[model samples]
Every structure is written in structure tokens, then in C-alpha cells.
Target chain A: MGKKVLIIDDSSTMRKIVTRSLRQAGLDFDTILEAGDGQEALQLLAKESVDIILSDINMPNMDGIEFLRQKSANAAIKSIPVVMITTEAGADILAEAKSLGAKGSIKKPFTPEQVSEVLGGLM
Target chain B: MSWETHIADATVEIFSTMLMMEVSSQPPLTERIKSHQDSVTGMVGMAGLYKGMLAIHAPSQVAMTITGNFLGLEVDSVNDDVKDAMGELANMLAGSIKAKLSDNSKDIQLSIPSAVCGDSYSLDYQPQQGSSMVPFESAGGRFLVELQLEQQT
Candidate 1:
């Protein structure tokens, strides 16, 4: 079975773009789910089984760092790998995300090659 | 590269690679008027080692074109897609620049992006440290990206 990927971002346009890029990067995934924010993503995680997550840092209800913190503490979903895709280019933000157990990160305006490289061996 | 070069590179990269539009940026301007009667403004705030704002302003028609290209749809008006796309563009630009500025230290925090659209409006920004505006032309339409930075007090 192919991997099940989940994408979380506030912008629907971004979600579409990331989805397209994932496919272009040659990651075979049977299911690709999406959420508008961390809260919505948690809701989806409770009801579904996702293998990997691609998330955005800044969001309305709950941000990616908080989501990572919550997910890290939950045994039911703690093992899933999260890759942050965001425009928050600060080193502090990146360190926080890493401390919260983010497996990797890809900055905004990324290319397919970069996505593929980051997802290497993770998927 | 300088901050202005970074902004120009990010703008060109985003539009060319993601939106598949060719962007031509003019020389950076130290002083310029940004607001327009019918324009879309996307803004993102930064706080930490540096505090200021980054914004992208484009005429409504230009914004619609960019949004349409981003979403692969035919956009004709200022809708949610236009606002969201512009905000995301600003977010991306801010992040890219922040990364360049924060290479050695972890001292930047980015705020969530916000967008506004109007038929007529004015923006009054008094930068305490530094600021620049760069105009870009793409697909026959023009837009401007502005960056302002100041040391946090």
C-alpha cells in the first residue's frame, strides 16, 4: 500500500500547490488528506490513519508548533513524521519546530526537487 | 546578496516556478507611494531581533491575474483566492528574507499574514530603521513589494 499523506495549511491555494508538488516529486501515496489548521488536522488524525504530515507553521486556530507538541505527547499519533512547510524563516521558529519533534522542514516557494529530497527515506 | 536582492529573487522565484509567470523587477526604489484606488495589499509582521512589516501591493487586476495563475483558474474579481494568494506570497517572501537575516542567530518571529482589498485607500508607514520598495512587471501587469525593518525597542 502507498503512504497516506496529510497536508495542513490555512490557504486552500497552498494546499493545492503542495499536493501537486508532492505528486510531481514522485512520492506514491494512496491517500492525501488536507486540513486548514492544526485543530482541524487533529480532528482528522483522530478519525483517520495518516503516515506522514506536511504542515504550515502559522495558522489561525492552532499553529504547527503547537500541533507538533500535542502530537508528540499523544501515544496514539506520536510516531508519525511531520515535515513543516512554511514561510517563517526565523531560526527560532525552526528550532522550536525541531524541538517539538518535527522530522524536517521545507521553506516556502519550494521546488519539487527540494520536496523529494526532504522526504527521502522518510516515506 | 543584499536584502533587496533577496526580495527580488524570492519574488521572481515564486512567480516563475510556482505560478509559471515571468517576472521582471525594476531597480529598487528608496521612496515610493504604494496604495492605489483599486489595489490588494498583503501584509505580514515580524517581531524578534528585528521588528517591522513586509507587504506586497498590486492593482486589483494584477492580483486577480496572479491569483488565477496560482490556482489554475480564471479569476475576474477580488475574491478569497486573491487575498489568500497575496497573503501567502507575502508570508513566503518574509520567511525567505528572515532566514537570510537570521542565519547565525535565532531571533525572529513571524506573525500570521493579513490581506486587504479596496477601491481606494491610503497607507501611512513611518519606518524607524530601513525600508525599500521594488516594482515588478509580469505578464503585462505591475506590482510592488515593500520591506521595512527596525530594531525592536
Candidate 2:
């Protein structure tokens, strides 16, 4: 089966960087998707399916926490895995994300090896 | 141990690890620079236990160069990519400083990143408790990371 990944981030630069990092990490997917925020990601997920999600914790409009909340409520997309890519290293928020179903998190200014080490097991 | 060192270390780490560029930090600025010419500024605010702002100011050429390095492309103008790249850099720097400020992540809250750039501009802020600006030299050029903070009583 072909794998698809959706990246949610307000910064277009960061999205591009993640796409490049996934490539650098050698985590190749059949299709790569993007969204500006959780709202956009949810909307996209409603019509399409992705194997996994990589989202930023801080974003305008809808944030990753709310996205996780809403996704967990929806049975259709609740099972898909999510990983946070953020600069927020606060244990409280990351713990919240874990409780909400975030598989893992990668901080900003992360290296390719770090990304791979986290996502390798999940992928 | 100072805010200057924190800002300097964060900036250098971001550039070296994320942007794949080696940057060197210079001595702390003795005076604040309010005006900028052909430059871009990326800023994020912190509220709650700590209240202040983190800003990164870079010349237009240097900003474009940094943006290029960020996205692995050649950038020639101060476009949206440059602004977003700069804002993300500010976000990362603020996050690092926030970690040093307190163990509880919820103690401080960071605002969404913002960017401002043009031919000429000036940013004015009234410092309450502590303020520091650190300069750095990258392959592109020199840039400064400025932080203003006041701990709530």
C-alpha cells in the first residue's frame, strides 16, 4: 500500500523544510500533503486519507491540541497517527498532546537524524 | 546566565542545526538600535509569568540569504518566504529562551510569530525590567536578536 503524509504548519517555510527533512530522513511517502493549521488539516482529512500527520503545536485559527480533540471525536480519522513538530518544549503541553494521541514530537531546529529516529519506528 | 547568552546560543543553534549554516555571536550591544534600513524584523511576544518580546532583525540581503538557506532555495527578494522564515526563527529562539525561564511550559505563553520589513522602519519598546540585544555574524551577514522581559510579581 502507498503511504501519504500530511504536514500542518502556519509557516510555509517550515512546511517546505519538513518536506525536505522527510526526504533527508529517507522517509519517503507516495503522496505528501500540507495544511496551514488544524482546521485546514481536518477539512482536508474529511475528503482525503493520509497515513500519518505532522503538525505544529502553535498556529493561528486552530492549534494542534484542538485538532487532536476534534480528530479523536471523529471516528473516521481518529486512528491515524500524529506527530508534533514544534518549538514548544514545555512538558505540560507536550504531555497534553500525548494524552490526546500524539505519537511523538520533534522540536524546531531539529536534525534529519532526529526526525528519522522518532518517525522510523512509527513509519 | 544572561538573556544575551541565551539569545546568542539559541540563534547560533538554530542556524547551525536547522539552517545548516555556521554563525558566530558577537559582544552584546551597548545601545539599542531603533531604526532599520532595507531590513526585516521577526518578532514574538511572551505573556504570563514572563512578559516580553523576542525579535530578530536582519538586513534585506541577509534575510533573503537566510530564507534561501531555510528552504534550500535561492531567494533574491524579501518576499513572504523571507518573512515566514524569519518569524519561525523568532519562534524557535523564543521557545529556547522560554525553556530557560522556567520548567513549566505553561508558565509562559508565546504569541504567534510576526514579521515586518521595508525600506525603512523603526521599532520602539519601553523596557521594563531587563533588555538585551546580541549580534551574530553568519555567512550571509550580521543580524541581531533582541529580547525584552519583565517577570510578573
Best candidate, DockQ: 2
Which lDDT values do the candidates have, in the order given? 0.88, 0.93
The 10 consecutive residues of candidate 1 chain A with the worst lDDT sum are A86-95
Chain B, candidate 1: TM-score: 0.93
> What would the per-residue lDDT of candidate 2 be over residues A19-119, giving only the tens digit for each residue?
99999999989899999999999999999999999999999999999999999999999999999999988888999999999999999889999989999
What is the two-chain DockQ of model 1?
0.60
Task: Measure candidate 1: CA RMSD.
Answer: 2.0
Which pairs of residues collide in model 2?
A: none
Runs off by more than 4 Å, candidate 1: A90-92, B104-106
Residue A19 of model 1 has an lDDT of 88
